[model samples]
Target: MSPIEALDFVGVALFAATGALAASRKQLDVIGFLFLAAVTGIGGGTARDLMLGVPVFWVERPAHVLACAATAVLVYFTAHLLESRYRLLLWLDAMALAAYGVFGAYKGLAVTGSATVAVVMGVLTGTLGGIIRDVVAREPSVLLRQEIYVAAAALGAATFLLLDRAGLPLWVTAGGGFAAALILRGGTIRYG
Candidate 1:
């Protein structure tokens, strides 16, 4: 798979893990884990694809759904081994946000060729899944938290666009965007 596609799959898996972690915290059953994981993995991308008039990604590629289901099962069995499931969830989310932000922006740019829409798509792709997860888990939404979540996603998308416009290689552009997002989100988790 291309780097962008790899990032998209990775984002799905990580976000699904976060959903499963939330389910574990709530003492939900395995089915609950699967439900949250599936939604958290694909919700944002599904919306993005629909808005772009593209085939919904998971619908087109069942592997994405498999990734979510596998991640949910893994986390369901393994979450208790972590010292702080909450902290791990935050970190996984940060990583997934970075991946999704970059990947989403790339998709938007590929489909629409509009940098403005690309950034918005990136933000939606990164944040929407987590928002759904939080709401279903009865956790405080990241938007309500005084953290650097959405801004990180925007910055990542913008960074990718800027680097792409500069004619940088795809690796550099994707890396820059992912790093920019992870650093900002990690800073918030570390400092606040």
Candidate 2:
């Protein structure tokens, strides 16, 4: 698969895993798991697309939904076999947050060709999914946490925009943004 496609798939799987974990924590059934996964995986992209007046990525490419559904199924069954669901959930969330931040920034840059717009879109894309997940689960959203959740996304987005402005290659900017977000979020999960 193309690199972009591969990134999207990974992001979808990670987001779906987090969603499934949330559903499982709530004792939700298979359908609920799938629903949560789908929402969490696509919520950010959908919001970004709507704001940009572009067609939603998942609507145009059904593979995104399929990938999330598959992840939901896998996570639903496998979650019972794993202990420390909380730790699993936090790590999966960090992965998804980083992946989405990178991909979203890339998409935003590609769409608007403006560094400012890209940064805003990146933040929107990274955080909206978790917001939707928390709302659906009727839990306090992570965005509201005193921990550095939104701050991490914002930092990653700004890093991507600045790197692009500095004439860095797309891959470099994307990878750096992803790494920054991952490190920051992981730190928060570990010590926050």
1-192 per-residue lDDT for model 2 (tens digits):
754456667777888888889999999999999999999988888888898888988899998999899988998889899888878988888877777777777788888888778877877888888889999999788887745877777778888777878998767877788889888999978887
Which sections of candidate 1 miss by over 4 Å?
A: none
RMSD of each: 0.8, 1.5
Against the reference, the lDDT scores of all candidates come to 0.92, 0.83
Q: Give the per-residue lDDT of model 1 (tens digit) for 1-192.
A: 777777888899999998999999999999999999999999889989999999998888898999899999999889889899999999999999999999999999999999999999999999999999999889889778944799999999999999999999998999999999999999999987
Q: Model 2 TM-score? A: 0.93
User: What's each prediction's TM-score?
Assistant: 0.98, 0.93
Residue range with the least summed lDDT across 10 consecutive positions in model 2 = 1-10
Error of 2 at 130 (Å): 0.5
